[model samples]
Structure formats: C-alpha cells, structure tokens
Target: MQDPRMEDELVIASSPTDDGISCWDLHTGAEHLRYKLCSSPPHGLASVAGRFLASSQLRNPKSSASGTILYWSWNKPQPEVKSFPAEAIKPLVSNSQGTYLAGGGVSGDIYFWEVATGKLLKKWHAHYRAITCLVFNDDQSLLISGAEDGCVRVWSLFLIFDEVRRAEAKHLFEYSFNEHSLRVTDVKTGYGGCNAIIVSASEDRTCKVWSLSRGNLLKNIVFPSIIDAISLDPGEHVFYAGGRDGKIYIAGLSAPGASNSSYGNHIIGSMSEHSKAITCLASSADGFLLVSGSEDGMIRVWDTRTRNITRIFRHTKGPINNVLVIRQLQNTSPRTSNHTLASPLRRHGAPLPSPLEKFVNSADENAYVKVFINPHTTSNQHLDSSYITVQTMENQIKELQQQGSSAAAEVDVERLKSEQQRSLQMIQQWKTMYDNLHQFCVDELLDPSHPGISSGQPM
Candidate 1:
C-alpha cells in the first residue's frame, strides 16, 4: 500500500454507519478511498501523517463493543490498529508531526499515546465533564482543551513530562479560563506559539479570545445563537464563528473599532447560507477557501474573497462532526480527474430538470411564439438551419421512434404541425390586410368626393 500524507488530502468523517471515513484529492475533489470502520466515530477523525487515519467510536449503550480507536491505512478497509482505552472519548487530535495522538474522554480525562508503538505516554484528569474540543498549538508543544464544564485549559507538553515541575505545581495546566457559563463547543489557537491567542466557542452564545501571553481575556463577542465552531483567518486578524443561527460571523481579535472596519464592537460581517446549525469548520492554509459542515450533512466550500459557496459536498445522512483541509502532498498527484471519478455525493430524491427545460422555463412564452411566427428572423435563422431543419427534425423523430419513444415523437410532430399552421395563418392575415389597404387606396383615387381630386379643377 502506498502511504499518503495527511496534508495532501481532504478528510471527512460521519456517524451511524460502518463506512464512514472518506478521503478525497484536495485539488481535484476526487475520492481516493473510503474505509469502513468497526463503528462510527463520535470524537471525530484524525490522519496519522499520510500513512493512516484514526477514528474514535462512542461507547455502545446496549453492548460493550465500542470506545475503541480504529486506525486505517490509505489502501485498506479494516483498521490496522484498534485499541480500547476503557473510557469513551469525545475529542481527538494529532500532533503537527503525527508522532503522537491525544484524546479527551467522557470522564473529563485526557490520554496521550505514541502513534508508532500505540504505547500510552500520559493520562490525566483535566475537566469535570466530557471534553468537547482539543487543539494543539502551531508547534504541537501546547495542547488546548475545552469541556462541557465551560472551562478552557492550556496544557504544556514540556511541563507534562517534567518530573521536577510536576511536583512544584498541583495542576499541570498553564492557564485555565472559566468565563464561559455553558459547555464549550470548540476551541482554536492563532498563529503564534506561546504568544498565540486562543478562542473558544460555547453553548453560551458567545466566543471569547484569550491571550496566552498575558493570561487574560482579550475579547468577548456575543452572538445571537450558540456558536459551535470557529476558524481563524490567514492573517489572524479576524476569526470566523459558526453558530446555530446558520450564520458564520466574522469577529475581530483587536479592540472594537481599532481596525479599519466600519462596524463597531468588532462585529465585522457575516456569511449565511446554511439552513441548519454549522457543526465544524476548517480553513485552507492560504485562507482562500473556508470549509464548513452543518447538521444538514452539507459541506460548503466558501471563497473568502466573495464569501459565497464555491462548491458543496453532501455527506451521509448524519450531522457532519469534523472537516479538515490540508496541503496536498508535494510528491503525490490526484489519482483521477473530477470529470472521471468524482467524490461520492449524497444526492436528493428526484433529479432536477435538464438545462434545456430550465432555459425554456425561465424565458417568456411569447418570445418562443415570436420566433416560430417569424422563422426568417436573424435570431431564429441559426436555430432553424441547425436544430429545426426539416431533415434534422425528421431524423430526430425517426430516432425517437426507433428507441421506443413513439409517444415523444408523436408530441414533437404535433408541435411542428401546429407551428407551421400558425406561421401560415400569420402570413395569410398580413397579405389580406395589405390587399384590403390597396383596394381602399384605389377607391379613394377614383372617388370624386375625395378632397384632393375635387380640388384639382385648377390642374
């Protein structure tokens, strides 16, 4: 099996089914592989470098078959590695180098493991409720966690391994934020390492940006609905917040009115197209595309310049819990073109009308009538010579009849006969009107009571 790098692919995961993980080519949007797992992932999906993928299953309510981590390679369907941590994990993350894996459990404890050996590196209690989100800093040195208890904590990996510092502090967290009054839904860190800004979204209907350098709340922006996910802008100037209101709000990290934005209080703008609550968000490295997943099972790719959807990928019939956009591997190319083998899309029932039908429906009915009435017109000349030619129409009717579409051929013949009759009637009416005018002129020329003839005595 050829190992693929995680950066070169777009990864997606869904729930309530055995076939869940799907990988697609980032450039071409062609699906490379689909893996069927032992169970649906609840804590979300992670790619271990480019060699394999990882998913965490929720513990089954009726059976003891879940709470397992499943790993799959690019070319295989079954998991290469499966481990049961004995606790149901909800949020999973990988280090920048993919050397280690970390998961947050329902018991509010975090577990770290070496990806190669599957050996447990560290496990500790971090929160009072299930962990909702986990993110690593740019260098993977700091792990940020959010929980249902509304506490956002930052833990340092260096300190986690220090035996001397471990004894000095009662807890290992570098900073603990308790501003949120509801469950924290998502958390993201900005560009800088230690000086980076951390933002947390919550069920409290607000997103807060905390300064890791100063250990203080930098900004708090409230929304109209509960915010579920957030993605930072490329420049780290503004962050996009997705909420239950089906809108993505752009909140500035700087102070209110400090930037060139006209909107005060850092409420810059919003992009609303999703009909359901957004569940997750991932931005491209260049920030040209912002991908968002919703409870409606739609993944929309937005152009940052226009703030409009550029492409849409429909996932399975379940709420999309995770979305990831990474760089395409430099060494790997797309396996297929989008025109050949496209990604699997969940299409709605009943296909749409063809383009020809759509164009006819959008146009005024009288315009088509005018074209048939005046076949010699410049606009209809091309169409008449090509599609409406007598030979062409006859050949098409014959083909339809040969294909057992006698009803369709009959309808076409009737339409053509009616059009020809209407054209002949219009021409006949125009000739009749012309003849009547000519006869009236002749009668007036001979009439003596006509003003010009009667007054022509001087001539």
Candidate 2:
C-alpha cells in the first residue's frame, strides 16, 4: 500500500534468522512474504519505498554460488520478486529517493546504479580488497564506503554526476585506518551529529569517530568484542554499536579535540539479550530509542535516555542478519501496523528463559540449516512433506471406501487404507517415543558439539 503521509512503511526481512529473507507484514503479526536468493547468504537490506527493497548477498562469484543483488517489487507479493543476476554489484546503500543505489564488491571496485534504468553511473576501482559497506549522505551528494583493506573512502556522488556531464573529478573526503588485527565491518556518515564526521567500525574491537573536516583522526571507542555492526544515531549524541559477544553498546559521541585518543565518549550501557552475536542495530530518529537484532533472532527496543529495555521482540526463527530503522512515522500505533516498524505483539517482560533454555531453543530453531529433522520420528516437529503425502493418500483411500465401489475395488481400497493406518500408527508410536529427538540433536550441536548426528533407526 502507498504511504498516506508519504512516509515509507516497514517491510521487515525475516528468515529462519538463518538465511534468505521473509518479509513480515508489521500490521498482521504474520510473515506473508519470502525472498529466497539463489544459493548465497544475504548480507544487507534497505527498503526505500513501500514496494521497493534491495538486498545484498555475500558469496564467492567464482564458486558455484555467486554473490548477487536482489530488487524486490511488492506490487507482486514478495515471493515472486525476481532476483536478477548481479554478480558484480554487491549492494551497500540506496539514495533518498531510491532512484540511485551504491555498492562495492570484489576487487574493491566501487559502483552505483540508476535503479529505474539499471544503468551503471559512477564506477571506480575504489579499493584493493573487497568493499564491506557503503552509505550515501542524507543529501545524496557524498558517498562513504569501507573495504576489507582497512581503508574508508568517501566519494562525491554529485561531483561524479558533474563529471559524467562535464568530465571532472569531484572527490570529497577519504581516510585510511588500520583494522589493527581485524577486518573492517561497516562505515557510516554522521549527518546530524557533526559536519563531515564519518564513523567506521572494525573487528579490532573498536569503533572510531573520524573528523572529516580536517582530514584527521579523532576518537577511538574501544568495544568489548569484535565489532560486528555499528549504526549512527539520529540527533547524533550517540551511536549504537554491537559485537559478536551478543551485546549492544551505546557509544556516546562528542566533538573531539586535537588528540585522537581524547576520551570524548561514554559507554551508555548495553542491551545484552541475545546469547550469541548481535548482527544488526538501528535507532529511532531522536536517538532516544533504538533496536538491535542478533544471531539469536531476537529484537530488543531500548530507551537510550533511561538505559532500559522497552520491548523485546522474538519474531524471527533463526539469525537476524540485517536490520534498518526508518523514522517516517512517529507514535505510529505502539502496535505493529502495516505502515510502521513497531515491535511485534508478544508477551513482554516474561522472565527471560534461563540462559541454558535460550541456548537450547536457539540450537533447535537453527538445526534446520544443515541437519534436517524428520517430524515422523520426532516430537514437537514440523509436519514433514512426507506426512502430507501420507495423509493425502489416506484421505483418498477413505474417499474411495465411501464411494460404495464393487467388492474387489473395496478390498483394494481397504488394503490401501490398512497400510496407511499401519504407517500412521507406527509414526505415532515413534513420535511419542522420540519426543526427545529434537532436544538430543540440539544438545549435540549446541552444547556438547556432536561429532556426528545419527537417528540410527530405519525409516
């Protein structure tokens, strides 16, 4: 649906939290959409408008599975959004109007595209290593990018536009920083907090705030673990940073003095809800409220001012790889609505399950990644496709029996029904006896780390 107030609504990309994307209708408390990228793990996502969303998949281009960019048009339900092969363009950011998109991929090649025309606009061999993240300023004039080579480069997109028209270089700002023993994960520009200030994060367990004005280093906020993801807050007082240790760190930002290590920021507590790493985080427009997503597939909304968790959402099944908070609507029904990114309806403040239970549940929920479970052999399992087939066959046999066929035909139907009934009986027996099958698999994978999994029984 088109936004009535011209503010784009929320189209959350969910998967098992394991891989791919399932778009949830925030209004319905249900996931009515899925975007299955062929063979690659999806990395980043941004919904520019009501119906248009772009995603980045990370995989080897030469391998059987290649990294590709996907464009989704919801005019058709989310499932059919054809992902065109974009082996070269690993997406990073789309422009304000969603007309232009920017991303860099293998070979540190930075690129942008005109979304409607699908034409390559500005292109450059931007880095030596693969590009990690890219973002355009709110004005769409400057593009900030980070690469695995431990360098952050800023490009003047408008200047490039002029060069396209008049052939000149419009370079804006560029900086190189040491990953200091880790890979750079992401870079973001602070538009509201400081002029020409760009923030970059790396696996070095630190988030750095750079002063783009004088081409100088500023402050370094040492984080607890390898920084997995970092997002700049609106109103710029603080920025949210999370690590692989499953904690959300609120690093307060300040105008730095001449010193690079000038203790300019404070750690404004953290939201440590997940058992594993936090993969994604975003903030509301005011910076007073923020949300974080993790490999545990949970979302927690935090009140930055009070340092308290407002609401915790456990809507996704597997790992949540990407999260973006767009501030188009305010006080938009505290409830999940079609037009917003509010928290999903769930029993709040339920004493968090014991840490062990959380870990065990995470293991079970994510076991489908490589270990396939058979519902016919396990308790509290999803109905396998075979169960559907069996049920369908049994229903057909019953229908034939009720048709009042001849004696020979009835006998045949009765034989088929007897077989199905026997199968169902056996299945029920196993289901009751093997209720611990899922728990056993989860325990092996998560805690004890099984060397090999085996049902060890004939199907």
Candidate 3:
C-alpha cells in the first residue's frame, strides 16, 4: 500500500467557529501549527509563495470598517501587514507570482489590490449577488470569478491593467457563463491557459464546463445534490465535485461521451462516507489524494487510486469553509519580494508542459529561484497558433451566429432592456404613491379639525 492519503503533509484547514487555522500532517495525522486569527476570514486562508500567509477577515458584518486583510510572514508569529478594505469580502485569491491579490465582496463586487503596498488597484461590479469564489489560472493571466448570481466570468489581467492605465471607459470581459440557475459556489480552471476548461459547481445541482478559448459551454453535469465545491485533477482529465448529500462524485472531462454514460463515462467514481454535507474539497498537488470538508466538522482524506477514505481529521464544531494543500518549500530562506509592483511577462505564445509534469517537478532543490510552469497550452482543433487574430475572432463570432442564434441573442438583449424600463416605471409609480401619502398625512396634520394633534406651527 502507498499510504492512501497521498502527499498531504502540508495541508491546512480552517473552521468558522475557532477563528484559528490548523495545519496537520495527513500521513501521521499529527498537528503542526495552531495559529490564532484576529477575525474569521471569509473563504479561509492563502499562502503567498511560501513566504507569507494572507487572510481576509470579517470582524463585524454591520460596521463599515468590518473587513480587513492580514498578512503574516512565515517566520513571524503575528501579522506583518493589516489593511482594511472597508468591505465585507468573502473570497480572496493571490496570483502565482504573488504580485496581485483579488478579493470578492458580499456586495457583489471584485477588488484587486497590489500585494506589497496594499493599494486598491481596481474595483468593479461583477454580479448581482455576493461573490462566492475566485481563482487564478496557472500563469495568473486570467482571473475567474464566481458569484451567487449564478454567473461565472473570466477576466484578462493584461487587458484590465491596460484599460486602467489608459483610463478607458469601456470595460471588457473575456467570457461570461450563465448556465447555472442558482448561486455558483465554486469555480476551478483546468491546466491550459486560454484553452482551459472552467468547471463551476452550483446550488442548482449541476456542474458546468465552459471552454475558455472558444467561449462556449462544453458540458453540463447534473449531480444528485447541490455541489458546493470542486477540485480539478492534476491531469485535467477528471474533477471531483463535493455535494451537500455527503458524496464526492468523480466527473470526467476528457472521457468519451458515449462510453462515459454507459461504461461510466462522466460519472466515473464516487466516495460517500460523510454523515453530513460536504462543504469544501481540495486535491493534492500530485493528484493522488482528494481532501473533503463537511458540515459535521470532519475532514476526510481520500485516496484517488483506491477510492477510499485513508485519513480523517476532526476540526472544530463548525463548518469547514476552506481547505488548502500548500506544497512545502524546500528551503526556508525567503526569495526577493516583488511586493505590489506587477511586471507581467508578455505571452509569446510558447507552449508549456502539462500541469501534472509541472506540479511533480516544480520545486528546484539546487537552484535559488523556484521553478514554475505558465501552462499556456492550446488546442489544435480551435487554435492552430498561439496568437489570436482579428480574423479569428470574427470567424468565431460568425460561426456562433449561425442558425439565427444572433437574432435570438438580440431579442434577449431587447427583453432585458424592456425589463429594466418596466422596473424603472414601477419604482417611479411607488415614489408617486409615497409622495401622495406624505402629502395626505401633512394635510391631515395641518388641519385643525384633525383629532391626532393640534397645529403647533405653519405647515
């Protein structure tokens, strides 16, 4: 036996009740660190390049200055930096290079900040409801945001930076997916950059895959219960969806359609041992283990090969909101910090190795600098070259416009416009009604014949 919990010696889990983080060695089931938190972070904690840890804390929900982001160095016991964003942000994600940090707010907005200075770089309205999850691609070129509005949108960092620098009025989103009918709980991007597939879990009891390159819906998988979280396989071949029914369903991405349904196509495997609903899930860096956190405050580590529970760690008597498996750094010495200065490397359309290969051999023991793959993989069927052309975009639009779908889309836009007008009219009518009621009350009060009160002054 290979000791089924995979390589989870550096795994960390956080509970809502404790306001503390617990790190454990999954193999031995021993505790490593029990760091106290100032406040409960919204979507758990994140580590930055093995140097420091970042958490978005919610001190008081009603206060204007309730939300604060705290940064702690690896060696220091206390937080090194504390910055109040003044918004109740729930989810936070950092880029691979550790230059930029993105947070999702309860007000359905996304805020981008520079790590070193803690400066607010950009803020935008992302969804109608609260944002639940945020994730960056391998190269940090794209940012995927999911919200309770059941919308998943992809944004280009390069384009965002350029637009901000130029102060352009027009905003551009790379892609927007509205396949989910309820709130989107989790969103994870697969290996490839532009050609990557985004798997989003929703409260609608479904998980959908959207193609980043083609900007289209590729697949929709229905689960028995609401899927709260999802983790992609290292090979990008399969994904694990944790549901409220206390089951982890293994859905396929590269599996054939016909064989997947009959010969266990998309739904390949499942693990159901938890007595409560699963709240969060995280896969090991090597893809050998799947860790799931449930409502019963139990964290179970499953062996992917054997499809069995290999280890279980009991957390606090609260829901486990976030679980992260950070790869331990080989050397303790810190690398030079870039802070908030973002110097993005230009994409030259170079192909990188697969995520599995990159994850296995990412750390460099001898070299001072760490090894990281950008994951700029592209498909031959849709993308023959690395660089996208104007003609290619036009062709894609034309292809999508086929079968009179463009007219249908136009109709949808018009319907939305009409709906907005109707809503405005309703508001105006309500305002008129309120004004009439106020005048009637004033008249009644000013009249001496009214029995409630006598007129004290001129109305």
Cα lDDT, all candidates? 0.70, 0.57, 0.70
Error of 3 at 49 (Å): 1.7
Q: Write the per-residue lDDT of candidate 3 for residues 1-459, one digit (tens) a residue.
A: 325334324567776565566676655666654566635543647765434567777777676357776766443446656666647778888776555578888888888765543445567787888888999887678889998899999988766656454366354577889888998889999876778789998899888999998999998888778899899999988899988888888888877664444324477768889988888898877888889988787889999999988888877566787788875432222222322111111122222111111111122531222112233432222222323333344456566678667765775678699879879998999999999999998888777876555544444
User: All predictions: root-mean-square deviation over Cα?
Assistant: 28.7, 27.9, 22.6
Question: What's the C-alpha lDDT at position 369 in model 3?
Answer: 21
Worst 10 residues of 1 by lDDT: 350-359
Q: Which parts of model 3 have CA positions greater than 4 angstroms off? A: 1-9, 38-42, 61-65, 75-80, 164-170, 258-265, 333-459
Cα lDDT tens digits, model 2, 165-283, are 43543443444555445657877777632256788888777788787666666777787688878878777777878889887776777644332323224665566767888877776
Model 1 TM-score is 0.68
Quality of model 1 by C-alpha lDDT:
0.70
